[model samples]
Target: MFDRFKERTPVRDSLTFLEPNPMRILILLFITIATYAFAKEKMFGNGSLPAFLKHFDTNSDDLIDEEERQAIRDLRAKLREKRRTSIDLDQDGEISENEVSMARAALREQIEQRRLQKFSSIAGEDDLISREEYTTIPGVRNLPDFIFDAVWRRLDTDESGYISPEEFLSRLLKH
Candidate 1:
């Protein structure tokens, strides 16, 4: 009985169940590579430099000359005053810990609301954003294909070729 049981199957045939799915392997590999590319882009890529120059470089020379530097300083001072006024809930010109906490909570709510609005705007009536729709997002159309694709893959966690509002909001909030 033991000999009969052991005699028939080939090793390769028996182990076929253990073979990896090519599609699954490919997806895993893609996710790993895309994650690495996204991280590298965030760390070593232009970051906020372009936006900074665009806002402060009034002359459009791509360089922050002394005048622009002074403008930035003035803007920072104005922003600081604005923030102080907002945070000092009692109008006492000083922000208490309670006021700080309240202001922080309000800011968080505002950010969440803005993100929801963005998701609604992008998703449109279909309530789903395809890769094409994603490219239409502000600043996304200008990205290199590789970087854009990596970001898309990272956001489309379900690999459904579309981004659901949950995915969009969660991914953005995480970062």
Candidate 2:
């Protein structure tokens, strides 16, 4: 219509405003946030057994042998002694994947509680996962917090919240 009217050309949209794709903008924002979070996250807890075998148990092995188990047991003893010394950094005694996870979870809980306690009243998942919760797990009958702590620590090697493939090898093979 403007062309037919012989009017002077108007500026194109880009020439007037810096409008970008809204969806793309949102996706970029989300990716930025996710990358930051991933970076901030403690990169450990590779508890998957398959991944462990992939790295240590050479020859594409699927099972752990006695010798392999002994090596793991030795590693655990070393790490335990190291924890007793200064390597643990946290000084809680004992070193394993789960112990690290629990400590971090506990820290996060404490930080959140401190922030929220000023206004609200509720507990985190850890606080809710009480002694009874541990006992409720099949084969973990009547286990106390100390036992749970030990088990959790052993499973958590890389120190991320969840256990990993290597952690399974370390804990089960060592035992």
Candidate 3:
């Protein structure tokens, strides 16, 4: 009878101990957080898409072409690496969820600022970007000559071959 009672005590103690294990709890927390993050990314496609669109729509046409997509991917990778290196407070090689969120937010802000600067420069004094004005931008000038005129032409709605500030903002910022 004493042996059986001792066995019962050990079994109950083991069960109680397992329930509050710190390592087990940590593993569970990590799994839950990771699952949530993966699902969120899959559903949302980069957290905030307005930021992505603003950055990737090089011609302000509200469409991301193959080249533009590749460019954006490259830019995103660079920005992520830069921010991770700077923001990883723990010095762990891996960035935490909070750190990644912070990096993404900063990246979004940078993209927005760059867009505003480029818009102001491209708009010039007239507040509208003429086809000629668009081509004058350094970035536009660097694009392949064949693709350059084509992209600008596509963005010039109404077949007017000119882009108004309203059109530019609407297309780029609409998301």
Candidate 4:
């Protein structure tokens, strides 16, 4: 090919060997710019893409070369490490959809259990909160043991052997 081209070198060669032919220079410049623009748009548009897939398909073939496949495996390992840190609550260094769901379910169950415990404490021994109970004691009110026994005795109006939770709350709050 070199033998085919004429030896009439231009003064512009001093600037760049490529500048000898303005058309050749323009064509080369165009090719370089087009290649850069295509590479940028096709591959790096979103940083979210897995690195291997971006570089593997220069000709746009779906399958990656062996080298690219190796690269992909390496990249996947690094990404998996990052993902494990992000989602693996147990810190086992592996991430799975089930683990994520399990973590969420555990948190929800904890919240629900706390809610049940809170409600149970509010109800105390009554099991159910009576309407008047909240009004009588807005906050925690200490009841003397003697007073409680006396009140219990009175609440067992029929002289039943024991006072039920309902009877106890009803009698205590009404007064």
**Which candidate tops lDDT?**
1
lDDT of each: 0.82, 0.55, 0.73, 0.60
- Model 3: CA > 4 A from native: 1-94, 139-146, 157-160, 164-175
- My TM-score estimates for the predictions, one after another, are 0.49, 0.23, 0.37, 0.26
* List of clashing residue pairs for candidate 1: none
User: How far in Å is the alpha carbon of 28 misplaced in model 2?
Assistant: 43
lDDT of 2 at 169: 41
Query: What is candidate 1's lDDT per residue for 1-175, written digit by digit as tens?
Result: 5776656479757876667987568768977886665675457656434552477878777678899899977986898799789899899878899998999899998998898888889889998999888878889999999999899998999999989988988898899
Per residue, candidate 3 scores C-alpha lDDT tens digits across 53-123 of: 56677787666789998996698689868866898968889779998788788887797778767888878
Candidate 4 stretches greater than 4 Å from native: 1-94, 134-175
Kindly list the per-residue Cα lDDT of model 2 for residues 74-148, writing each as its tens digit.
Answer: 886897576445434556665667666766777767765564442122223433233344345577675676887
Deviation (Å) of 48 in candidate 3: 45
For model 4, how big is the CA root-mean-square deviation? 28.4
**Model 2: how far residue 104 lies from native, Å:** 11
**Regions of model 1 farther than 4 Å from truth:** 1-82
Please list all clashing residue pairs in model 3, or write none if there are none.
Answer: none
Candidate 1 lDDT (Cα, whole model)? 0.82
List model 4 lDDT by residue over 94-117, tens digit each.
767888898678777776667556
